[model samples]
Target: MKDVDRGALAISAALAGVAGYVDAIGFLDTGGLFVSFMSGNSTQAAVEVFGPGAAVALASAGIIAAFVFGVAVGGVAATLLARPRAWIVGGATVAVALVAVLAFGGETTLWRVALLAAGMGALNTLFLADGRARVAITYSTGTLVSLGLALAAAATGGSRRAWRRPLLLWSSLVGGAVVGAVAHRGGSPFALSLAAVVLAIATVILAVRPSTPERRPAAER
Candidate 1:
């Protein structure tokens, strides 16, 4: 891979760690609802709306709405920060802060959780808009599917054999989740602290000069 892509991939890995941390804690505390995977939330909301009727429907709807709202905020932030790579790190910062508050704040509530979910969605949207294919650092459902497909391609005798990085991405996520879960077991705030640490590290990586940059159009360059 080119140096620029490599740099982006490394950044993505760190962000993946952040995502996994967020996901693990979100799952543990939020009654199986997933914030990073908005699809899951949306699907759950649909089930609540259609299956059990309007009784528990509002909960799923709220989660889905919060997730979408987070994504919108992230997309806007990413667009604004597109030119400067630091913006990606900035998104991470927001994620870490929001999660910390929701997880650790003494006065946190359900509404706070909803706000945190939106913030996570926003950080994830930043990753999406970054246009780095390997950097689906915020979500894993598609990453797992991609890994399986890539492995299948490799098994089918195609020379495209590019499973290493994708595997790395997968492992990073799982590892991060494990770390987050363990931390959460100790104390919920601990998981968010871990996330903040990872994001801070990612920010430092961005601050470092790149060996070589991937050239983009003048607008992005």
Candidate 2:
């Protein structure tokens, strides 16, 4: 197989799509709480705290904590282990699969939430190198911001190639969201399981790829 590093941006975009799909599940499950995107959750937390009372805010806080802990786990694994990116992606698939099973079994506690968050957190490690997040597969705000900048740069006569990566990533995410919504209609467990399958495929691709060159702590494309 060709080296994935050579097509890192493409793989990252695909991962972004998976994240969007899972995130859609979380959104539908929680009625607006984001499992992968903490910014959205934080916003919801604040709103709940002020408007809906402490119960909702508490749940949001727990999700945020889970996400944060998952990020820490993924980051540490990448920094301390070999083939860190592949390991993280593999772990993410497993975590997601577990969450899917639990959901199928009618589990809806914070433990399941933590597993989902951890899966999302592990995905962030796909672009981890030099101790920083690269493309941010789990969130779209940065990707959208980068897209705007890329377009602005192009409008100022910069090369349009700079815009290609972000545009693709954003499109992949939105496309995943559409698929996720549809899959969710079938069943939440099915949608979650489908996401796990996608991540598992990504893990296989990463497992077969050659080692990448040293990376800088730059934002994902």
Instruction: Name the best candidate (by lDDT).
Output: 2
The TM-score between candidate 1 and the true structure equals 0.78
Best TM-score among the predictions, by candidate number: 2
How well does each candidate superpose onto the true structure, as a TM-score?
0.78, 0.89
lDDT of 2 by residue, 99-180 (tens): 8888978746766876788778777766654566767677788878878888898899986667777778888888888888
lDDT of 1 by residue, 83-153 (tens): 34455455657666776766655743556557656656655543342354324666677677777877787
lDDT of 2 at 56: 74
Candidate 1 structure lDDT = 0.64
Please estimate how well model 2 matches the true structure, expressed as its whole-model Cα lDDT: 0.78
Q: Can you give the lDDT of residue 218 in candidate 1?
A: 40
Residue 185 displacement (Å), model 2 = 1.2
Q: Where is model 2 more than 4 Å wrong at Cα?
A: 1-6, 214-221
